[model samples]
Target: MTETLRASAPPVATGAGAIAVLRDLASYVDARAEAFSARSSWLVAAATHLAGEPVVVVAHEDGQVVGLAALSVTRHRGTARVTLLGGELNDYGQLHHDGPRAARALAGALVDWLRAQRRWSLDLTQLAPEDPALAALVRLLPGAVVSPGAPMPRIEGVGTSYRVKRDRRRKATGAFNAAGRDGLRAEKLVLDDLAGLERWLPALVEVRRARDHASGRRSQLDDPGVLAFHTSVVRGAVAAGAGVVHVMLVEDEVAGFVTVLVDGDTHRLYDGRVAERWLAYRGGTVCDIEAVLRAQDDPGVHTFDWLRGWTEAKFGNAEVVRAGLHASSHPSVDRLDRWEATARRRLKAALPDAAVRRIVSR
Candidate 1:
């Protein structure tokens, strides 16, 4: 964890070298983040995908990817938004480090890289409270609000309630029964028993897209790689003996769904979506609740994170709220506000009332 301060941050200047970092990342990430991030390929792939983009920067450690930062640039709505591409499901940094100081060094390197690139700002998704890298970033960049655009969703554990929490015996079981009586079913998939995800991906994508269209929003399913990555997540989760994709079928229909990220000690829910048609049943909550019940089966799991944004249900139900930290050197809390104003002005001038969406390249 000791500091080995480098004179400069790493970037992909030469095509051959950038390709090397991508490959090294793909390999080392396969090992370092192997167990931590369930979908190791996607996190590692972030560097590979961003390598081809016009603007992308990565921090290298001895020709290996000890750390990386991806920026997804778009000039939508006449304003620019740079998505600080990390994990879409959670706003957490998965740096390859031996200790906290190693993580900090990487953070400093990434912030410096971004600033050098002249990016207006960045948006990190699904921010986690325990990320020490982000903590160090806040130390360097005092002006960044960790929670700017994206809001973390609400989350709760089955055992964190009163009626079932009075005693430890049967906590999850009690909650599951209550949910079932309320017309919700909670269960995990037997990896071998279900259809191959190669087959499931397309159908799942359709369901997700339709759900999004019905909600008047764009489905993440629109992107082929994003869809592929999600598909990989399902496959990886099952292969690791980690957890299953819990589905909340309403009246024998895929009413809501959530992919639970699992390890021995942590269980996280991602891609949680509920159809607008199921509002009466709180379909989203139903799926979320069911996922938690299934997670309880893993006695080793102690923390259930909503993973990024704050939500009404998650805050109300969770006994412990993991507050995410945002550290940046921007030095002005009003920077985001100022950028937003510029974006608004640019949008009006450029498109003249047309909805401008900056196409984010991988």
Candidate 2:
């Protein structure tokens, strides 16, 4: 076994230097089967439009970069708060690293550096439960508040259970039959035209919005900033051939689309939107199943990750369910954030879906 030689650098402010480090780390992570969220393109896209100051720490061994963590720092009433970079944008958070060993070393180095800093609060969310970094942090920080996060569902090849496979087949068949009966031609394609993509993106969002509105739920792509960030990510991914927009057209009209990010042998289901009118025909599910079928046929793809969310649509194809982590440590802010989150959840539950949507819209 090679002995680990660890050296940590001072926090680098967000800029070209930080981006370069992220790119290097992303390349390292991408070469392995690491989370797609940790890929270079996603990190760069998220870092470019950070909501707070970024503090990037790079770790090295034998003068070679091994791992890094990008953090966002914000101040409220003179109290500094730190969070994982692009926490909102990521489905899983882990320090970008070479592998498990590098992950452990980098996590230790990061914890040491953070301990040396002045008074500040740390809130790390969307952390993968088995992530070595997360394990190290939980072990080192005793008083940290650790919470169970959302479940991320994923499909392993076809499906593990007969029920799941049956559901998927039923949906796929019924959807296609419905389209045929309605005289609507349906086709799914790997969209590569940049100009056409630019035009269709807004329409996609609108379709998503309409679907959500019909369901009396709030849309994730409602914010302009969020839309802009997604655009950057989509464009970057498509340009590099690491991503593809699978569009499902019905009778020459847009019915639905899914944005997929390919990392190594895994194809992540990043974001999707379906026309409200096409919901009766399971347009969204058809688009997703089409991607899943294509991925299953590919010799390279081993996993179809639905990233995060436990929607019924994901369950039909999902064979595994993974959970994320949320941990927080602070002298003054401990438990407050968690309390607020709980309150928000309760309030959302108590209100009607349409009322909740109205509140979110305003």
**What lDDT does each candidate get?**
0.51, 0.69
TM-score of each: 0.61, 0.80
Off by over 4 Å in 2: 1-11, 15-17, 23-33, 61-64, 98-105, 116-119, 145-148, 157-167, 183-187, 192-196, 213-217, 315-331, 342-353
- Residue-level lDDT for 180 in candidate 2: 80
- Tell me which residue pairs clash in candidate 2: none
Worst 10 residues of 1 by lDDT: 353-362
lDDT of 2 by residue, 14-57 (tens): 55666655654554545542566666666776667656766677
lDDT by residue (tens digit), candidate 1, 18-56: 434434445444455524342345553443443223233
- Shift in Å, residue 324, candidate 2: 4.9
Model 1 misplacement above 4 A: 1-39, 47-83, 87-89, 100-104, 111-200, 250-252, 276-286, 310-362
